[model samples]
Target chain A: MTTNPNTSTLDYAAVKPNDTRAYSVRNILSHVFALVVAGFFLYAAYGKIGPVNARQFAVQIGNYKILDAAYSNIPAIILPFIEVYAALALLFPKTRKAGAILMAGMLLFFICAVFYSAIHLGLSIDCGCTGKGGSKAGWGVIARNTGLLIATGLSVWLYQCGPCAPKTSVDS
Target chain B: MKHIFGVIVILIVSVITGVAAKAMWYDTWSPTKAAPPQKMAWVKQQTSDAIAKTGADRNQPGTSGDASEKVTDNDAEVSDSSGATDASLTADAAVSNDEPEFSGGFPVAKLDMVVDHLINGTAHFVDAREEYEFDDGHLKGAHLLPSSAIYENIENLMAVGVLPGPGKPIIVYCGGGSCEASHNVAKVMAEFDYQNIYIYVNGWEEVMAEPDRFAGQTE
Candidate 1:
């Protein structure tokens, strides 16, 4: 019997007949990974969106010295909300791929920025990842962003190949 | 590709909505404020008190001499030993004399000059350290204006006399020579057209190392 893959439950027997249980476990793990990433984005956005924090975040962005004040204000105003949107998108199955892509892009940007600041510039300012009182930017922040990038990539792959994919009967 | 476009659209909408909400609720969107008019009454009082304390201390034999005399003496010594290890401690803990000019165009002051200003009460001290750090200890009479809150509280700082005005000499400092909080706060003050801003590069660590020279210690 064919089961609709998009309905949330994976017909694991049809998808991977030899290892239905393993397929099911993999599917569950993928969902968990997506949820965790979504939660992370949400938490990051939460710290950065308030009136006071948004301004502080702007200042932190200014410290990078890559962008002038006019250009810096644009990201300072939009980045947190984009983070919020990405988190919401990740929570919904239909939008998971888009969310994962956006998150990966953001993580890549962050990793690059952290690497540049820590290695090239030798700046010891706060990473400003989680707004005010953020920990200093260093190799550790790069490591964390790299890990999150890996998780996001995995989630995207799982969504494309697992339950979120279209289903077809094994006999067909 | 379509999905990516959709995501971009959503993000643009979200930013607009979020900014609109901020504008509605917060009353002002700009992070900075115009420089307030100069107010010197409270500054005069604080300066007088600081001067009196310095004068009294100078009378006690071991204290530094009068403000002008000390400034001249310290200036000579600072110019001579500008980059040398401070005589106060181990070589490892030497105060850094390489005070980089702040991007905001404010002048950089060495530890001795800062201490001189503190003694003479010619400059108002603004501590840009975090609240807990300020609580632990700070330079005597230093206003706790953490960098995070400087823009929001600029007016409050002015009202409370922590910032006397644009014309008053304001010395901003933080944890150490490398700490950016002092520079950041100084930048904001400069943006507000503060005329005589100075960054105390060696900051609280150097000052606290010799507590006898400076006054307030709340650790």
Candidate 2:
């Protein structure tokens, strides 16, 4: 009996043979990861030039030097789309990889910005990563981003491993 | 190829869901609490209550001794003390765009009243509207310092001979009555420790309504 190779690669005996457990932990992890990512994107999109002026966000982006005053308004308008797209991408299997890659890249950029500001800028300027009350990004922000990146990376890797396939009678 | 494709699909789904969830958590579920003073529902209730109470008190016959008189008297005192305080409070109800002050208070002011002070040279007028709007038309004596760049270009107000120092009263406004950009700019001024930062809630449109009273004329 020919069986699915991807299932075996996924490390689930159901997809392979023998070992049987009532439930696999993959489903729970996927749900949790999806919830986390979706929530973040939705939140960021809300404040993006909706009622709140883009300049407020520009001031935030200014701290990182990723965007200057001239392009400040542009990012504010574009941010809402980025957030909505990122959220939808994470929910769908076909777009998950692209979403993961994009999310990871953004996180990495944020980490770099925070670290750069802390080391070179000496933290005098506001990091403006979050809301108006957002504290200057520092070592703490770097650690937080690193953890989130790892989680996203894991989700992407495990997803590639494939879903657990039901075992076949060939082994018996 | 099929297996690879399936795996890709699942991964993509996971990512899309995750990002969406993340956005929702922060923007919606996380900070569900609405800011005060900006909630239109509450403001609406207060408006009706004030108007109804005033109407009812006036409708009541003698021995009530003119209840409407008492209401106007109170309104007069508040206005005399705070210059159009009742009107400004009503104006606050007009716009839902309330920038949460760092100190947690919604700033409001009467544009017509502020402009009156500016024209009389009693107060300095600062146009907190965007550059484009200011260029289109703004009060004559009003100097343009877009709200977006209030923090960065604040010194320009001084350069324009508008905002001289900390003690001088400053009246700030953006576009028309509905815009909160001026309110945000006023907050920035307050953050800078400007004690007398007045917000022109009625804005330029309302101020321009009465031609003679306004000092800064715009086409």
Candidate 3:
């Protein structure tokens, strides 16, 4: 990628694509956020599938009253695979875009699930957000997800548009 | 791409399904209904002993400085058998009593003393370990309640209906001094009003070392 020095107005213009500038910074933030989400999901899924079992997870979801009678065993058996996939997907550059979008969507769904459970269903259960550290469903979860959503959205979008073109010339 | 979508779909469906199943399985989160309180008999014996001691003291020459009333209030505070207070009050008080009970500061007990209390029916010693670790032969009577479930199922202790209230003494020990779960649990128990809480720093490693004294085995 190349950029003309005299005509560009973007602040990131000074940053070169391969010059250890905005590109690296952006990549670092994006990967970090992706890994964070992956870590959270992996921990949650592990709790459900490994030791704590999925009953607790189902109980939180049951607060929504959507599926009614088949909540526990389903999450217990399925979440580990999805979490592992999400974690792995973020590592591959090709898959990173889709992974970010998927992560954003998952977080959005969780926020909605918690909201619905709190207001519409009127049941209060821990969000199991922090794995065993006791992160419950509340404004904190929403706020945290909203921040991640913005960061992740920006990362995925910027990466798609391509980093600012190198300014020192391709030969340099 | 197709596989990823399939995996997401399955994940969502399963999470939703699991939620529904848990709601139907248990009507309430309390678990005391499954195991009756083990303290009632002990309470009864203590009450009778208290009454006998008080009676003997009252009959003595210069010991009539409000014996019965003080004894009555103390006994009633614990197990008022006469229903002067609601059951919830007693239950709440009992729950509070289970808080770590320490007097005159954090008195460090000897390892043998800790094990003796655990084995001689002094405290409900619990081992906060993973299921596999617990199944591979934990301290004989140690209850296997993992740290992960401690917060989620603490209300289950309320369900047990026999907690020693907010000031009870409880000793929490994990795998070893390096394990954080036991100390973490001890801290939470303190928050819940467990007054005399102690973290067995050496935990199982220390306990297992002297099996004859702690694990009921003559090594």
Candidate 4:
């Protein structure tokens, strides 16, 4: 390829074609939020796989007293993999919205479960956020889940096919 | 519409994978599998594995050490499969801390004594593990009084005639291995002035060590 020698080459004020700044702020923030939410769910899912974890999670759910013993096992078996799928979805462009929605729904469910256990039942039990050891169910866990819910919402809407995608950045 | 489809796909795949994984570990986590209590099941498997490993190592000259012989010699008599060798309630527990300080001034149950008690049904056995664990496996005729649910289930225990009675021995056990559920249950029982409460500090793990004899005793 030959340059046009007659033309002025310098365009210092304009963003360089290869500049990192060319990555739109919306895209960058979305990527960051997507990664954070994905990492959180992935770690959360890690501790819930396998039979030992299933047993612990079953007991944790039983602590909630909302579900009978027979019913709790269903969630114990399926919930971890749900988190895993949602996390992987968040990492992919095609399914990011689905992941965000699923995670947001899960956070809402968790917030309610914790609130019911802590406030309604007045039970001081292990939150079982992670399989074995995690914080107790109370205001702190609710606050943390709320933060993650907001993060998931932001992750979905910030860029690249999201409603909040910048007018200029196509993520090409 | 696209997001809904994607969400459904993720959920469907997750549910399928989870069910398949459960089937893969059926022996460990199958809901329909009617198995003995966890204590019995774990102890039996561990015992058999240890026996098989020991059989292979027995030919090794030094490895066939006198540990078993020492145990037999240290105790007045080793418990047979029926646990009928000793009739005493405290058959010289192998634990170091049996004093008042260890179990908060509570009497501790010996393994042999526990077995004998279980067989004879002379004592009320309180399972201190979670309800789910108790459902999986527990001592035969043991009361399902999980320490965490004690307040809720104590009345039920009374209704079921599993309540601790005067002069009758109460043996409380948990999942062992630093498990304090038994102690916690005992604390509550103490408040009600329950007599002859014996805390099994080693609990399920100690029973698991001799699972061949214990397995038949569990549900």
Candidate 5:
């Protein structure tokens, strides 16, 4: 194989295209994780955005007591769309990093909310995660959010470290 | 930066599409228009049939009308006609000329008033808690009419013969104070023209807190 005279041996090996099986695996894993997370968000958004369910979703948000009744409607209105957009972004290779980051941030926010509801607020209301009649907000909900966060983090890492990373002039 | 902008554009488009779809398809898209009111006469007819059924059951041979009273030794304070009158008067006075001063646009029932209805067997109790919560514990003779179920299949409730006719007073409750399930259920009942709907604001939690007051009747 012809190599660039100016390139160091280690640098050439690191960017070599032949040993791409690991990259393929990492890419596949990232896509799988992204799809799973995207499906979850889409399903959740569907459950929450329905006409009848949306009102209930708003009420559930109000029950958290984190926002006033007037402001509770805002999240009820916008969050579902945001979820849909994030899920869509995750489906495409070019936008996967942005999607992963957004999903991770959302999962972290949800974890904090669930944790507060379980520990600090001492509330026993529905978590409203799926937009329908959800189970009670408690440790289980926090754990679920934590799992999603970890998955999103993995997706971000794989996107950054695997074949999806941007090519530099040295690779060419 | 380009990806960020792309995400923002996607978000905006998603929201617009969602809003448009909701507006076009959902009858409940607008807050004010959700849950259109039912005819008062239809509600009256339903209530009358229920009352007639109750009357017929009371007259049946060997069936004791006082069975409920015997089951609970706690004599409700508002059982007497005079006490009922006073309670009704208090509730009426609380109402203004405009919107009713009740939580769910229905009359508010004090615990004693609810107990009186329970003893007399004149009211139907609807537990608005989830099925699992209802299964855990609930008032004796209470029907599980969860808010979510009602939203999904209101006809199922009517078909099941659980919802008493308009003539029978209905008492709805959830977990307890600040719990919106009961209120939401009550609103739906009111829209159906159930005129004598009442909300027990301090619901299962309060009843469980003072089991003696309920005469240990909770199941």
Candidate 6:
């Protein structure tokens, strides 16, 4: 199993099956990150879809006081589906980046809304982030969203570095 | 560019699926139609008509049992601030001597009484908060009667057979801390001729404070 002295170090590492393919740390980490994010978003969407209460969800949206009551219904109707689509898009290799982008954008919006409603307005209302029964939108929720944003960024970055990414490297 | 295309595709799919899902379970949110922009006078007329219907249809009482237990002194001479103070309506109301006397148009109930009503189904608990807050946790048998679109919400309420016209002790509560949602909802209830409406001022906050006792009471 020893590398021949004749082979150069760069070529030797490249030839190691463990190093490049089956055991690539970058690949596993990327998928793991994506899996976590996808699982989370899917779970969130499930909560919304399970109850399937658009009007109630719209009221939840209105609680943020960000959107006018009239405007809240459309988002409430569509947001859960968006989460599901984004999570699916992320799991697939072709649309992973796009999903990540969508997820990151949503997380950013949620963070701001939670901050404004829970922290700024001091409303003791539920966040409704993960559908019904979500906790109040407060500092703790802000921290959680921020962490999710970081994870989202890392998922895409790591995915790009993984073997699934289109490669332009030349072998020695 | 591909990423953008992929995102657009995802968005389109989401919109389509969302619409389908909304259609599939339209009943769950059909009540929210009240929030849309509607002719005010028309809505008011519809609401008044509904209220009149409710007012006219108040003959039957709740099924005999604990329902009759919450008898209110409809003719009680309560002060403005303590609307039901001297009424001593229910055993739960008289259970505690430390209960806060009302400070508003309606009588205020203590957490114990609210919890008791919840357990016994002695009163129809109407949650005055938004649907989302009600979803988080609310007293069992609580009606989500937010005051925003009272006309439509009440119609929805009536559709569900929850006619609150001068019958059971209607306990209305909201997110406590200086929140006026409960009071607003109570006023609307009064407009519908709902006598014996009690306000649980420290509603959600109090219920949330004692996680253990009220834990099982939430929907």
RMSD of each: 9.9, 17.1, 15.4, 16.8, 8.5, 11.1
- Flag regions of model 5 displaced more than 4 Å: A1-18, A70-74, A164-172, B28-44, B47-101, B104-106, B147-150, B162-166
Tens digits of lDDT, candidate 3, B144-183: 5555456565545444432433223355666674444464
> Which DockQ value does candidate 2 get?
0.04
Query: What DockQ was computed for model 5?
Result: 0.38
Estimate, for each residue in B1-219, the C-alpha lDDT of model 4 and write its tens digit.
999999999899989998998888733643223223663355345435543443344334552234433333333232222221121223223233243223534566767678888888878888877666677788899888775545446556555554332334678888775445576567556543344567888887787788887868988
Q: Which candidate is the best by TM-score?
A: 5
Best candidate (score: lDDT) = 6
CA displacement after TM-score superposition, residue B81 of candidate 4 (Å): 21
Ranking of candidates on lDDT, top first: 6, 5, 4, 1, 2, 3
Q: Against the true chain A, what TM-score does chain A of candidate 6 give? A: 0.82
Better of 2 and 6 by lDDT: 6
State in Å the error of residue A55, model 2: 2.7
| Candidate 1 chain B, poorest ten consecutive residues by summed lDDT | B84-93
Model 5, range A20-85, lDDT digits (tens) per residue? 766888888888888888999999998877777766677667666677756766677678888888
Model 5 CAPRI quality:
acceptable
Per-residue accuracy of model 1 over A57-154 as CA lDDT, tens digit each = 77777665567745776687788888988878877878887788889889999988878866787754667787765376788889888988888887
**Stretches > 4 Å off in candidate 2:** A1-23, A166-172, B1-219
- Give fnat (model 3): 0.11
Considering DockQ, which of the candidate structures 1 and 6 is the better prediction for this target? Answer: 6
Off by over 4 Å in 1: A1-20, A164-172, B26-112, B119-124, B127-169, B174-180, B187-196, B201-219
* Models ranked on DockQ: 5, 6, 1, 4, 3, 2
Ranking of models by TM-score = 5, 1, 6, 4, 2, 3
Fnat of each prediction, in sequence: 0.32, 0.02, 0.11, 0.47, 0.30, 0.44
For model 1, what is the error of residue B210's alpha carbon versus the real structure, in angstroms, after optimal superposition?
12
**Cα deviation of B193 in candidate 6 (Å)?**
13
